[model samples]
Target chain A: MTISWMDPHTTSKESRSCIDCHTDPKALGLGAGSLVKIKGSWRLVPATSKSRDRRLNIPRLDGFVDISGKPLVLTSRKDLRPFDAAELKRILDVGQCLICHKDFDDKVMKNWNSLSPPKPCKFFLKTR
Target chain B: MKKRTTYLLVALVTIGLDTDSTASYYLGAKIIMGGNNSVVECNLAKVEVAGSNPVSRSRQFIKTGSHCCPFFVQENFYMHPRRRLLTLAILFFSLAFHSLFPCTAVPPCQAAAVDSPSKVSTTASGQIDMCLSCHDERPDRAHGRKVLGCFSCHLGNPLTGSAKLAHKGMVLNPGELYIVSKTCGQEGCHTDQVKRVKKSLMATNRGIISTLRYYWNESKDHDADLTVEKLLKSDLDTPAIDYYRKLCGTCHLWLKKHTLPGFLAEKGGGCTTCHFYKPGVGKDGKKTNHPMITKHIPMKNCIRCHNRSGRIGIAYKGIYEAEGYGTPFEDGDVSEGQLSDGRYIKRLEPDIHFKKGLICIDCHNQKEIMGDGNEKAHFEEQLEITCTTCHDGRQRLEKIFEEDIKRPKYPLLTNLVKKNGNFFLKGKKDQKLHPLHRFLDTACRHPVHERLACQACHSKWVPQCYGCHVVSDKSKDQLDKLSNKQTPGRWEEFRSFMRYEVPSLGIKKDYKTRQDKVVIIVPG
Candidate 1:
């Protein structure tokens, strides 16, 4: 119930925009997933899965489609992990993003802030 | 047939050109030996007399075309003797030689091979690419520095414009195991390296052979102890050879560089093991000549052979190409992972080093991977680098292994050490000294996990496919439904893969010793 999407008064237009939801660390599964699990009587269990996203609170890649029609994004759920310390520059930096994303394309995140709301792209599944 | 004709013509011209003293020469030996033992009446030179010579005789018809004849049999016969004596001597010589060296034809039961061109190049300079006659524009070769023409690697007649003649004795992929030595291990080139590669695990596939043989109990001897040369030369039993040829044969360095329908066309051979680029793609959206011999090797090249069995290179990158999946991830599938041309690849992961722009050669020394020319029983024994070798900068390893990192091993650790004494690696950006930094003082600096390999802790994932089902003879259709490739003889393998991207830790077992060793293992 913490996210805006969870709020009872959330609007349809906001849900449609990928940027409004995905770019947010909390909106994406980056935040601890579902604080409580029902063991017998709704006990609060921390979500400590072994996925890269779980160990470190992060999205590993910037979403961009490649030349031969291959996107660099992790397509499988098994590999969802926090971007390691090494991947920081590649994902966040302006020069590296432009490699595949191109200069100021329509899909470019306005300010392209990862922590901000991300644009709605099906490629970043569950990230939103 | 034409080669024989050409050689015959050459020998005739050579003998014909020398009109000095009388010389009885033996010809047509090559034609006879070329499996063309069909007897033919040969024309021996006539004795030119003064029209009234006392020993004048009719033309002597000599039967020939039986076996291979060396070019210099006329040397000893020039001593003496007149017309009939010389003719009699020459006839006697031909009969003796033909009887000794019989031209036995290949039996009809076995497939008949028409001819085999001599394995000789026209020139030592490695020039003359018949491929260049049509493929004139040399896009880019991996070994461009050598200035060698196409014929250097692809052994075919380069000067001849005719496609068939040019392609004569031409191998589609010189990188294939059968010819890697001749193609890559030429006089001045990768001779020593190719020698070692013939023995290298990647080429010989010693570990896989031993493991499968032991696992199946096919042979008690297993031929594991024999050197690669011995193993190749030794006549293996039918079941063992069948197992090797059908089930496990495709990955060996001898495997040809051709593409199966749903597989990458991995160029298999000595230098091309790491050098020859596969499935070459250009920006123009057209296929180009992918024959490259270069140091700029990508991880995918290693995966072509290493992919299914142990799955080392792909595991290093965290991308497991399980058998169920259609295509193993190429560099295009993982690293550049995407291009803005609205293209994307889904199934892949990069190792931590790869993510940090470190390639396979970054950590592994060339000589170490290629071997220092000494043959070892197991490839694992030859590995030089370890976790401590780079991160720890610790003491020398026991005398069990060699410890020397070649100069310019990689740009990261290439002699460019920092002032604090620890080796420094140049970062991808800003030329930052990404020191092979050891933080022992602050971190847990104990030997708790010293026995564990570097991959034990650092590896993000290890791919383990439970059932590797290879049926030796698909034609037989004798499938042991319960048994995988472990069955004594079967070829076509169809196994469902169970991928464990999560770090899979296991207690290492030494089959040779028949003991459970404490040595830990992941997907390295």
Candidate 2:
């Protein structure tokens, strides 16, 4: 599934894109899927518009990612900059989604979906 | 009768009576007339005298007795003069006989005439010719007195006492003098010493064989036929061997012939004959400037160090026993009081100092003694004056540690400190740093270590470095260029520095090719 998010703050012609926070492991809620597991298994899920409406977890997921992965997404976060394929590959490779999600099995997916959301996301989801 | 008549006639002749007929007749007539007439005249005179006086007889007698028979008688006798003439003739004949037959008493002229033939010749040329007849054999008498000739010593003219000839202006006797002087007494020449040296360690057949073996070991071609032995024995013109023999022959002869105890000869008078400080290219392409002059130290003086009696412990085993100490003399064992002979003496602790099987040249070298100038003057100045020439003061004290301490291990790091800070470290603390770091710390201090590597400064101990780095292609090229570029007087320094210093350093710099490349992991 494809994921999208709105600019939290906008002032000039160049506004923040959804990929800025969601794609970067350094940003809040960016690495939430890496932390949660069911039946000792983990999976990465793309966020839908409905899921974005339900929760705004940022800080909790960021803590789950290793420090080395934090700077990867910051390289592509600026809006209106030229889209770099090599940079996109580097980000996807670090996220592990390109490899894990490409050949997703039903059983693995079912276990993945059953897991509880991380604290930052659950907090926002409960509040909503 | 005839015999009697002959005897009478001979008697008459002897008496000078005229035997010829005419003389007989005149004699007879004179005798007849004079006998009678003389007698009658004498009688008449007497009678006349007698008649004159009564005592005429007495008077006549008196007259006859007192006077000549008177003038008348004389006149009558004169008329009969034959008698006087006869008497005169008899006297003349007697005189003639005496004159005709001289007695033993004769004049000198008559005697000379009778004894010798009186014609004699006198000439200067004839006398000179007589002299030349005997003396002609010895012409150029002075020239003949040369040693080559018989007259070399036997000088002077045989004939003339006036003139003198000598073996003048000639210096040496040809046969005996030249041979003895050239072979025995000439200052630097020593053919007899050469003969003696042949029996020495350096010049013996065995020595040549060993040297050849050493050379063969160093060479790439290892074929037995091409070995040093074969090369020496094989009639090949090896300039290296020739050079070795020539240079080694000089001092080796002295060692063999002159010194007492004869240790050099026993060891090999040619100790340095084959074992010179030779410079050449090493396995690595570097120059090797071996200090050639250093190996030629007179072996007689080696006793100062190498003798059992020497103070420096220069003996084969002495140095090893003296290791780890400053000077052997510094310790109480080598006391000033005990050294009656004035040589430096010390108690040698074999266990602590001895490196059982070590050679002296392994540590000491001529370069250290002679310096880089390699001039005769410099060598003479430094030969036995300094301790560092034979001993590495730093290594002996264990100040720098490049190699394992063979004996008498001492703490060197404790002594070294940063001049800026007195902070010091010992053993492992100091050893833990990188090799380069330790090198910089020790070598970069105030003097900035003129010799960069441990081997460079301790060259006498580590002479192999010189062999490897002295004559490489690069250095040869540099030397060739330098030969052309350097000014005349200043060139020797450049040559020496290049030949000795550059090569020595090059060995350390080109450490990759060096055999001593074992990486030492300092214990942390």
- What DockQ does every candidate get? 0.02, 0.00
Question: A84, model 2: CA deviation in Å?
Answer: 46
Q: Which whole-number lDDT from 0 to 100 does residue A67 have in model 2? A: 25
What docking tier does model 1 reach?
incorrect
Q: B212-299, model 1: which lDDT tens digit per residue?
A: 5544566453336533344556656555455565545556565545442224334455466677554475434556555545665676
Q: Candidate 2 regions off by >4 Å?
A: A1-128, B1-441, B444-452, B455-504, B508-524
Q: Tens digit of lDDT per residue, candidate 2, span B1-524?
A: 12222333344467655444222212222232324464465443442222211122233433452354565332222334564455334433433343364344322111111111121111110011111222222212112111012221122211111122112222222112213233222333233433333333222233333333334343222112232223334444343333333222222222222222332233322323322233464333445442122323333334332332112233222222222122334544433232222333233222111232222332233333313232221112223222222124334333333322332232222223333322222222123211111222322231212322232222221101001111222122111110112211111110110010111111111122333210100000
**What is model 1's DockQ versus the real complex?**
0.02
lDDT score, candidate 1, position B350: 55
Deviation from native of the Cα of residue A29 in model 1, angstroms: 33
